[model samples]
Target chain A: MRLKDRVAIVVGAGQSPGEGMGNGRATALTFAREGAKVLCVDHNLKSAQETVEMIGANQGTAMAFKADVTKEAEIKAMVADAHSRWGRIDILHNNVGVSLSGGDAELLEITEEAFDRCVAINLKSCILAAKHVIPIMRAQKSGAIINISSMAVITTYPYVAYKATKAAMVSFTEQLAYQNAAYGIRANVILPGLMNTPMAVDTRARTFKKTRAEVEAERDAKVPLGKKMGTGWDVANAALFLASDEASFITGVTLPVDGGASVRRG
Target chain B: MTRLAGKTALITGASSGIGRAIATRFLAEGATLLLMDITEAVVEGGEPTHKILDVPFFQGDVSNEKDVDEAVRRAALPTGRLDIVVNDAVIRIGKKLTDTSLEEWNRVMAVNLAGVFLMCRAAVRQMLTQEIRHEARGRIVNISSQHGMISSPEDVSYGTSKAGVVYLTRQIAADYGRDSIICNAVAPGKILTGKTGRAVEPRWLDYSHARTPLPRLGRSEDVANAALFLASDEATFITGENLMVDGGWMAG
Candidate 1:
C-alpha cells in the first residue's frame, strides 16, 4: 500500500508480443498492487486494455488509454484524461524503449527513419509528457517522476539510437530534478540490464533466428549474479521504490538494476 | 507485509547519525537487530539507540578486527543467520592535506578504510555459510561519502578512505555476486544528521547549500531510507551500486 490512492500515469504500459512480461506492464501492475490508480497508456490499445484488465482482476484501480506517445496532441490528451479523472497526478512513469523491434542497428546500417522513431519513443516522449505534467505537478507542489533508462548507457551496446537516447534521458532527468526541487517534485532514472522481459529476450530470439533457450542462456551468461537474467519484477520493484515515499530524499540519481555488470565499467 | 520481516541485521556506528537512523528504520520493518559502536554514547545527546530499541549493543571499535568478528558472530546468534550488515563506522579528520599530521591521517584510514575492509571480510565469511533467502545469502551496505567522488572541501584523508570504500563495495559485489551476497554503498551529501558544531557552522552550511540542488538540506532519515532500500528484498537485483541520496548534490 505504498502508493495508496495515488494517481499514476504509466506510459507504454503494454507488453510486447511474446512470452514474458515487459517492463512497462510489470511496473504498472506493481504500482496498482501497491494501491496506485494507474492510467495504462500504450500505442496498442488492446495491449494497454489487457494491462488494465489484469489490474482489475487483482481488485486494483486502473484504466487503459490509447496514445502513440510520440505525438504531442495525444500525449496532452492522455495527461488531461488522467488529471480530469483523478484531480492530481502523483506519479509519472515513462517506460517506453526499443532496440531491435524499432529497427535499431549499428551506426552505419541504421536508417534516419528508424533512428528518429527510437528518439521519439525513447527520448522525446519522456520530455513531452513531462512538459505537460510538470505544470500540474507544480500546482500541487509534489510528484515523483521515474524514467526507465538502460544499463547500455554506461555499458557497451551494439545499437546507437538506444544508447544515445537513453543517455540523454538520464541527463534530462537530472535537470528535471534540480529545477523542480522547490516544488517538492523528485525525478530519478533506473537503468535495467538484460532483463528477462518479452521485449528483451523474445525479440532477440526472433531477430537472431535462435531458440528462446539459446537467447536466454547467452544473456544469462552476461549477468554476474546467480548467472541468471533479472526478471521484470526487479525493475518493477525499483520503480515502486522510487515512486513511493520511501525514496523521499532521493532525486536525480541513476540506479542500475544490473546486478554487478555496470560495476565492471572499464 | 513488512519489508524486512524476520531478517537479522547488524549495523556498525549505530549510536548516532546515519547508522542510528538506519537501525530504527530496519527495526520498524521487522528486522531483528544487533548494534555495534565504539561506545553507547549518542553523539547528538539523545538516548542510546540500542537501549531505546531494546536491541543488543556490542561496544567496540570497528578498527579492531577482533571486535568486528565477534560482533558478526553474535549478530548471527539471534537467528543463526546474518542477513544484512551495514559498514558505517567512520572517523573524520577534516583538515587540508598540508595541515594534516601523519597520526591524524593514519587514524582516519584505520577507522574508515581498514574498518570497512575488516567488517566486510568478517560478514562475508559468516554469510558464505548461510543459505540463500530472497535471492541473497546476505547484503552489505557500506556508508560512503559524496566527498569521495568529488572533493570534500578541506578533508583529504577522509575523502580518500571513502573512495576506497566505494571501490571495496564494487569489488565485493563483483567477486561475491555468484555467492548471492549483495553489496552496495549509499553516498550521502551534506546530511544534517541532527549533529551540532562544525558541520552546521555557517561557512560549511553555505558551501553545502550551494552545492546541493534540493530545496532543503538532507536529514539522517534521508540516508536511512536509501540504506533501507538497498538492504531489503526490493533491491535484490541491485549490486555494486553507490546510490546517492544527495538531493541532487552530485548531480548538480
Candidate 2:
C-alpha cells in the first residue's frame, strides 16, 4: 500500500487495437493495486472503461473519463473532474504516444499534416495537462509527475516528429522540476525502449505489413538484455517507483527502461 | 510479498550511513545477509549494524583482494549462491588538488575505485557459476554521487574515483548482459547521513541547500530505497544505469 489514499490521474489510459496491455493501462492498474484511487482518461471511452472494470474486479478504486488529450479544453476538464471528485491530486502519469498510427515517417517522407498531429497529440497534450494540474498541486504542496518519453530520444529512430518531440519532453521535465521544486512538485521522465505493447508492436506490424513475430524478433534482437523485448509491466513498474514515496528525493531524471540498449551506445 | 525474498546479498561498508541503511532494508525484505566493513564502529554512533540486524559481519578492507575474496567465499557457503553485491565502501580526503598529497589521493582511489573492482570480480565469478533467477544471474549496485557527473566543488580525487565507478558499472553490464548479469549505480546528492564532519559545516550545508532544488537535503533511507529497487526483481529490464536519488540537484 505504497500509495494508500492517494489520488492519481492516468492520461491515455487505454490501449489501441492490439494483443497486449499498453503502458498507460498497466500503469493505471499498478497505481490502483498500490491503493491509489485512479482516474483513467482516454480518447476511446470503451477502452478506458475496460481498464476501470479490471481495477474494480481487484477491489481497487477507479473511474473512467473520455477526453481527446490534444484538445486544450478536454485536458483542462479532465484535471478539474479529478480535482472536484478527490479534492486533491497526488500523481499525474502521462503515457500517450503514437508513431505509425499517427502517420509518422522519415524527414523527407513526412507530411505537414502528420507533423502537426504528432506535435498536437504527443507534445501539446502533456504541456496543457501540467498547466492545469500545477495549481492544485501547488496548493497541496505535493505531487509527482511521470512522463513516458521514448528511448528514441537517444537511440536511432526513423521518425523525426517522434524523436524531436520525445527529446523535448526530457528538457520540459527538467524545467518543470526546477521551477516547481519549491512547491513540492516532482517531475521525471521514463524512456521505454522496444516494449512489446499494443501501440509499440501492433501499429508497426500493420503499417509496415510485417508479421507480429517478425517485428517482435527484430526489436528483441536490438535489446542488450535477455535478447527479448520488455513488456508493458516494465514501464508500469518504473512509473510506480517514480510515482511512489520511495522516490520522493528523485526528480527531473531521464531514466531509460531500455534493457541496457542506451548504455550500449555509450 | 518481500521483494528480496530468497536472495543472498553482500553489502560493503555496512557499519554506517547509507550502507547500514541498505543492509537494514535488504534484510527486512527477506535477503540472507552478509555485512562487510573494515570495522564494526558506526559513524553516526550506536550499536554495530550486524549485531542489531543479527547478520554475519566480516571486518575486512575492500581494497585487499584476499579480504574481498574471503568475504564472497563465506557469503556463498550457506546458500551456494550470491544473488546481489553492493559496493558502498568509500573514503574521501576532502582536500583540494594542491592540498592533496600523493598519499591522500592514492588512499581514496584504492578504497573507492579499486575496491569496487575486486569485490565485483569475486562476486561475478560466483554469479557466473549459478543459474539465472528472475532474468538476472546476479546484480551489483555501486553507490555513486552527483559529483561524478558534475564537479565535486573542491574534492578532486573523490569525484574522479566516483567517475571511474560510473564507467566501470557500464563496462561490466555491457560485457555480462548475455550472461544475465545486471549492474547499476545509485547516485545520491547531498545526503545528510547524520555524521559530524565538514559535510555538516554551515558553509557547506548552505552551499548544498542553495544548489539543491528540494526544500531539504536527503536522508540515507532515500538512497537505500533506490538501491532496493535496483536490486529487486522489479527492475527487470534496467541495466548499466546510474539512477539518481537526488532531490533535483543534478536536474538544475
Candidate 3:
C-alpha cells in the first residue's frame, strides 16, 4: 500500500537456482506485492521471466525485459521500453553486480579488461541508467533511486576495482541527491553484509575455493548477532522501505543491512 | 502472539516523546515494560500493572550510578531476565558552543551519553547471567539522532552526545557479540512528535522540506517502525549499525 500505483524497474533481476533469492529478484517481487507495477530486467531472459511469472502468479502487475546493462544503447532502449509500457518510472533499483577473481592481487596482476569490465557492470551501469532516466524523472518531478552496495568497501575485502567502484557509487548517490533534489528526485544506497543467497554462495564457492556449506558456515560464524548471514529478502525489505513513501524524507544516505557485521570488530 | 511476547524490556526516558512512543509500541508488541524517567511523571499515567501487563515505573537520573542500579534491580526481579534495553532518554539543549553553559553541557552529556553507558553495562551483565535461549537473545536499541551523523549548528551538546551514542553502540556490539548480545542505534531526523508543533517556523520548515528530497518531515511512528525491526528477530544479523530513519535528510 505504501507504493500504491508506483512504477518500479528492478535491474539485474535474474534468478539463480538455489535456496535464497538475489537482491534484484526480491526487490522486484517486493515492489509488486506493495502495488507497484514492476519491470524485471536482467541479462538472462529466462531468469527475468521467472521473476515476472512469480509476480503474475501472485496477481501482481509485472513484465520481463532482458538487456546488458553495461551497454549504453541497451540501457537506453530498456528505459524507453519501460516508458512505453508503464508510462513512467517512479522507482529504479540498480541491483546489478558481479564478484570477479581479482581479490588481493598486486597492481601488476590486475588486468585492464577485468578492471574495465568491473567498472562498467558494477558502477558505470548505474551512471548510464541514471543519465537516461533523469529526464523522465525530472519531467514528473518525483522519483526514487536505490543503489545496492557492498560492505566490502568498508571492510577488508581486497578487490581493488570492486571496492573503488562501490565507494564511488556512494559518492555518486550523494551527488545525485544534491543535483536532483530540486526536482524531487531522491537517491540512496544499501550496503549489504555477508548475505546468504545463491549469488553469494556461487561467488564464495568459485572465488574463495570453499564449498557451499563451508562458505555459509564461515559467514555465519563471522556475524555477531544470530551468528548467521542475512537473506536477500532482508535487503529487499530495506530497499522497499527506502523506495517507498515511508522514506519520503530520506535521501543521500547509505543504509547498512548487514546483521551487525560491520560493527562486530569496530 | 506479540512480536515481543513474554519478553521483559527496560526503556530509559520513558516519560515522553520518542521514548514514550517506543515504550507504548513495545507494550503493544507484548513486551513486559519497565519504564524509567528522570521525573516521577513516568509513573503518573497510572499505577504499575494495568490490566494483564506488568508495567513497572522507576524514577531516577540515568547518570547516577545508584539510580541506574536500582532500576536494573527492580526490572530483573519479576522475570529474573531482561530481554531488551532501550536508551531513549535525552534532553534537548538547543544552543551553540559559545552559548552553551558548562553546567548545561555536563548535564546533557551525563544523561544522554553516560547514562546510556551505565544502563548498557547493567543490561549486558544481566543478559550474560541469564540462561541463553536457542532462538531468542538479548537486544539493545539506542536512540541516536541524524545530527550524530551530520551537522547540527544549533545544538552542539545534543549533536555531540548522539555521536557518542553511535560510537558507544559499536563498542558495545564489538565487546558482546561473542556473548549473543546485539546492539544498534536508530538516528531520526526532524521527527514531528508531541514535543513538536505542526506550526513550524515558516522559514525553517520551508528550508527543511526543500532540502529533504521527500519534501516532508518525519513522524515518530516512522522511527518506531524501524526500532521494531531492529528489536525483532528479523534483524538478527544486524549489530553496531546506526539505522537512520530520517526521511532522506542525511542522504542530501
Candidate 4:
C-alpha cells in the first residue's frame, strides 16, 4: 500500500537468461503489489510480457511495452505511451546496464564500438529517459526517479566504459535532483554491489565459462555481511523505499545496496 | 501488513520533534516501544510523548552510562530482545568554535557523541546475546545531521559531534557485520520540527532556505520515515550508510 494509486514505469524490465527474478522485474512487481499501476518496458517484448504476466498472476496491475532505451525516439515514445495509458507518471526507474556481453574490455583492449554501445546503454539511455519524463513530472509537480548504477563506479572493475559511464550516472542524477527539486521531482541513484541476479552472476558465469555456483561463491566471498551476495529483492526493496512517499524529504542521494562491502574496504 | 511486528524497540529523545515522530511511526508499524528522554516536557511545547502514546517512559540522560544501560535493559525485559534502537537524543550548543566556552563544547559532545557511544555499546552487548531474526541480530538507526558532512555555519561543536556519529556508524558496521548487527545513520537537512530560539531565528531560516534546493523545508515525519526504513526488515542488507534526507541540499 506504500505506492497506492501511483503510476510507475520500469525500464529494462527483463533479464537476460536467468533462473530467478531480475532487479527491474522484481521492482516492477514490488511496485505493482504495493498498488502502483506499472508499465514494464524492455527491448525484448517477450521478456517484458513475461514480467507483466507474473504481475498479472498476482492480481497486480501492469502492462508490457517495448523500447530500445538507447534510441532517443524510442525512449520518447515509451514515456509518451506510458503517460497516455496511465494519464500521469509518478515514478521512472532506469535499470538498463551491460558489461562483458556488451563487448566491454579494459582501456587498451576496448574497441570504439564497445565504448559507444556501453555509453548509449548505460549512460545516454538514462539521460534520454529522464529528458522525456521530466516535463510530465513537472506538470504533475511530483515524481521520483530511481537510477540503477553499479558499485563498480567506486570499487575496482575491469571494464573501462562500464566504470566511466556508471560513475557519470551518479553525477547526472545529482544534477537532475539539483535542477528539478523545485519542480517536485526527486532523483536518486542506487549502486548495487556483487548482486546475485541473472544480470550479474549468470552473466559472469557465462562470460568466464564458469559454473553458476562458482561465480556465486566467488562473489559471496567478497561481501562482508554473512559472506553472502544480496538478491534482486534487496535492490527492489531499496527502490521501493526511494520511490515511496516515505522518502519525501530524501533526494540526490547515492545509496549503496551492498552487504557492507563498500564500508569494509581496506 | 505490519512491517515491524513482534519487534521490541527503544527510542531516545522521544519527548519531541523527530524522536516523537519516530516513536509514533514505530508504534503504527506494530513495534513494542520504550521511550527515553532527559525530561518529560517537550521542547517544541506539547503533551509528554510517552503519555500521548500510552507507552512506558524511562526518564534518563543518554550521556550517563547507567541511564543508557537501564533503559536498554527495561526495553528488552518484556521480549528478551531489543530489535531496534534509534539514537535520536542530542544537544546542540549552537556556538562557533572561537565563541564557544569549554562548558558549551563539553555539554554538546557529552550529549551528542558520548551518548551515542554509550547507547550503541549497551545495545550491541545485548544484541550479541540475542538470536538473529530476518538476517539481523539488531538494527541501530542514529539520527545524524547534514551539517556533520559540511559546515554547520556557526555551530562548530554540534557539527563535530555529528561527524563523529557518522564515523562511529561506519566503524560499528564494519566490526559487527559478522555478528548480524546493522548500524546506519539518517542525515536530515533543514527540518522544521517546531523548535524555537536560535534554530528558528530569521537569519538562520533565510540561510537554510537559500541552501535547500526544495521549495519547502522538511517535516519531522520526513526523518522519522527514513528511520523507520532503516529499522525495518526492508533494509536488511544496508549498513554503514549515512542516508541524506536533505531534499537535494547535499546534491547541489
Candidate 5:
C-alpha cells in the first residue's frame, strides 16, 4: 500500500529456475505486492515474461520488456515503452549485475576486454539507465533510483572487477543524488551480503569449484550471527523502503542488507 | 509471543530516549529486561516484577566498571544466562571545537564510548561463561549515530564517540564471531527525541525537513523496528553490521 499506484521499472528482472529469486524479479514482485505497476525488464524475454505472468496471476499490474541493459538503445527503448504505457517512472530499481571470475591479477594479467565487459555490464548500464531516466524524472519533479550493489564492495573479495564496479555504483549514487536533488529525485544503493539465491548458488558453484551445498555451508559458517545467509527478499524489502516515501529525505546512501556478514571477519 | 520470549536482555541508558524505547519494545516482545541508567530518577518508575512486569531497573553510571559488573550480575540472576545487550547509554555535550572544554569532552567520551566498551566487556565475559543454547550465542546492539559516519559540526566529541562505537562494533563482531556472539550497531539520523526536538533551532527545521527524503524526522519506533530485526532470529546471519534507521537522512 505504501507504493500504491506508483509506476516502477525493475531492470534485470529475469525469473530464475528453482526456489530462489534474483534481485530484479524479487523487487518486481515486491513492488507489485505493495501496489505498484511494474515493468519487469530482462535480457531474456522468457524470463521477463515469467515475472509478468506471476504478477498478473496475483492480480497485479505488470508487463514484460526484453532489453539488454548494457545496450543504450535497448535501455532507451525500455524507458520509452514504460513511459508510453504508464506515463511516469516513479521508481527505477537498477538490479542488473554479473560476477566475473578474476582474482587478484597483476595489471598485466587483467585483460582490457574483461575490464571493459565488467564496466559495461555492471557499471555503465546504471549510468545509461540514469541518463535516460533522469530527464523523465526531472520533468516529473520526483523519482527514486535504487541501485543494487554488493557487500564485496566494502568487504574485500577476490572478484576485483565485481568489487570495483560495485564500489563505483556507490559513488555513482552519491554523485547522482547531488546532481538531481533539486528535482526531488533521490538515488541510493543497496549492498546485499552473501545471499542464498539462485544467482548466489550458481556463482559460488561455478567460481569456487565447490558444490552449492558446500559453498552455502562455508558462506553460512563465516557469518557471525545466526550462521546463515540472507535471502533476495531481504534485499528487496530494503529497496522497497528506500523507494517508498518513508525514505523521502534519504539520498546518496549505501545500505547493506547483509545479515551483518560484511562486518563479520573470518 | 515476544520475539525474545524467555530471553534475558541488559540495556544500558535505559532511562530515556532510544534506550528506553528499546527496553519498552523488548519487554513488549516478552524478553526479561535489565535496565541500567546513570540517572536513578529517570528509571525509577519502570522496575521489573514477577507478573505483568518484565523490567529490572539498575541505577548506575555505565562508565564505571563496578556499576556494569553489578548490572550484569543482576541481569544473569534468574536465568543464569544473558542473551542480548543493547548499549544505548550516551551523553552528548554540544559545543564547537573552540568552545568545547576538555572536561566536557572527556566526560562525554567516558560515558558514550567508554560505557559501551565496559558493558560489552561484561556481557562478553558472561556469554563466555554461559552454556550455548542450540548453538544460539549472544547479541549486542550498539546505538551509534549517522553522525558517526558523517560529520557533526556542533558536537565533535559526540560524533567522535559514535564513530568509535562503529569501530567497536566491528571489532567485537570480528573477535567474538567464533564464540557465537554477534555485535552490531544502529545509527539513527535526525530522530525527533526530547533532546533533539528541543535543541534543533526552529529555523533549521524547514531545511532539515526539505532535505530529508522521507520528508519527516525519525521516531524512536523506527529505530526500535530495526533493533527488533537485529535481535530476533531473523538476523541470525548478521553480525558487525551497522543498520541505519534514520528515515533516509544519511541517504540525502
Candidate 6:
C-alpha cells in the first residue's frame, strides 16, 4: 500500500509479444499491487489491454489506452484520458526502449531512418510525455517521474543511437530535477543492466540468431552477482521505490538496478 | 505486511542519528535486531535506542574486530542466520587537511573505513554458512555520505574515509556477489538528525540549503527508508549501488 490512492501512467505498458513480463508491464503490476491506479498505455491496444486484465485479475485498478509515445497528440490524449478518469497524475513511468530489433547497430552501419526512429521512440517520447505531464504536476505541486535508461549507457554496446539517446536521458532527467524542484516534481533515471526481460534477452535472441537460453546464459555470465541476469521484478521494484513517498527526499539519482555490473569499474 | 518478516539484522552505531532511525524502522518491519554502538548515550540526548525498542544492545566499538564478531554472533543467535547487516558506525573529525592531526585522521579511518571492512568480513563469513533465502544469503547496507563522491566542504578526513567506504562497498559486492550476498550503500545528503555542534553549524546549514534542490533539508527517516529498502527482499537484484537519498543535491 505504498502508493495507495496515487494515480500512475505507465508508458509502454505492453511487452513486445512475449511470454513473460516486460519492464513496463511489470512496473504497471507493481504499481497496482502497491495500490496505485495505473493507466497502462502502449502503442498496441491489445497488448495494453492484456496488461490491464492482468492487473484486474489481481484486484487492482487499471485501464488500457493506446498511444504512440513518439506522437505528442497521442501522448496528450492518453494523459487527458487518465486525468479525466483519475483527476490527477502522481506518477509517470517512461519505460520504452529499443535496441537490435529496432535497427540499432554500430555508428557506420546504422542508417538515418533507424537512428531517427530510435531517437523518437526512446528519447523524444520521454521528453514529450514530460512536457505534457509537467504542467499537470506543477498545478498539483507534486509529482514523480521515473525514466528507464539502459546499462549500455555505461557499458559498451553495439547500438550507436541507443547509447547516445539513453545517455541523453540521464542528463535530461538531471536537468528536469534542477528546473522543477520548486514545483515539488521529482525526476530520476534507472539504468538497468542485463535484465532478463523481452527487451534484453528475447530481442537479442531474435536479432543475433541464437536461442533465448543461449542469450540469457551469455548475459548472465557478465553479471557479477549471482551469475544470473536480473528480472523485470528487479527493475519494477526499483521503480516502486523511486515512485513512492519513501523516496521523497531522492531526486535526480541515476540508480543502476544492475546486479553489481557497474560497480566493477569503480 | 511486514517487509522483513523472519529476518535477523545487525546494525552498528544504532544509538543515535541515522543509525537509531534505521534500528527503529527495522524493528517495525518485523526484523529481529541486535544493535551495536560504542556508547548507549544518544547524541541528541534521549532515551537509549536499545531500551526504547526493547532489543538487545552490544556496547562496543565497530573498529574493534572482536566487538564486531560478537555483535554478528549475537544477531544470529535466535534465528541462526544473519539476514542483514548495516555498517552505520561512523566518526567525523571536522578538521581540514592542513589542520587535521595524524591522530584525528587515523581515528576517523578506523571507525568509518576499517570498521566497515571488519563488519562486512564477519557478516560475509557468517552468511556463507547459512542457506539462501529470497535468492540471497545475506544483505549488507553501508551508510555512506554524498560528500565522499563529490566533496565534504571542510572536513578532509571524514570525506576520505567515506570515499574508502564507497569503494569498499563495491569491492565486496563484486567479490561476494557470486555467493548470493548483496552489498550496497546509501549515500545520504544533508539530513537533519537532531545532531548538534559542527553538524548544525550555521555555515554548513546554509551550504546544505543552497546545494539541495528540494524545498527542505532531509530527515533521518528519509535515509532510514532507503536503508530499509536495500536490506529487504524488494531489492534482491540490486547490489553495489550507492543510492543517493539526497534532495537532488548531486543532480543539480
Candidate with the larger DockQ of 1 and 4: 4
TM-score of chain B of each: 0.99, 0.99, 0.90, 0.99, 0.92, 0.99
The residue-by-residue lDDT of candidate 1 on B134-240, one tens digit each, is: 89999999999897999888999999999999999999999999998999999998899888888899999998888777778899988888898899998989999
Off by over 4 Å in 3: A1-4, A16-19, A57-59, A101-106, A207-209, A264-266, B1-8, B24-32, B40-57, B69-81, B95-102, B129-136, B148-151, B194-214, B246-249
lDDT of 6: 0.93
Instruction: Evaluate every candidate with DockQ and list the scores.
Output: 0.81, 0.87, 0.44, 0.86, 0.28, 0.89
Please provide, for model 4 over A1-266, each residue's C-alpha lDDT reduced to its tens digit, 9 standing for 90 to 100. 99999999999998889678889998999999999999999999999999999999999999999999889999999999999998999999999998887899999999999999999999999999999999999999999999999888878888899999999999999999999999989999999988888988888888889999999899988887777888888899999999999898889999998888889874
User: Each model's fnat?
Assistant: 0.77, 0.81, 0.55, 0.81, 0.35, 0.90
Query: Could you tell me how far off, in angstroms, the CA of residue A245 lies in candidate 5 after the best superposition?
Result: 4.7
iRMSD of prediction 5 = 4.1
Q: How large is the C-alpha RMSD of every model relative to the true structure?
A: 1.1, 1.0, 4.0, 1.0, 4.9, 1.1
**Which tens-of-lDDT digit does each residue in B103-175 have in candidate 5?**
9999999999999999999999999887666445788999998886888747899999999999999898877
Q: Which stretches of candidate 6 lie over 4 Å from their true place?
A: none
- Interface quality of candidate 1 as DockQ: 0.81
iRMS per model, in Å, is 1.0, 0.7, 2.6, 0.7, 4.1, 0.7
Clashes of each: 0, 0, 13, 0, 15, 0
TM-score of each: 0.98, 0.99, 0.85, 0.99, 0.78, 0.99
Alpha-carbon shift of residue B248 in model 1 (angstroms)? 0.8
lDDT tens digits by residue: candidate 5, A82-175: 9999999999999888774323233556677777787887899999999999999999999999999898888867656788899999988988
Order of candidate numbers by DockQ, starting with the best: 6, 2, 4, 1, 3, 5
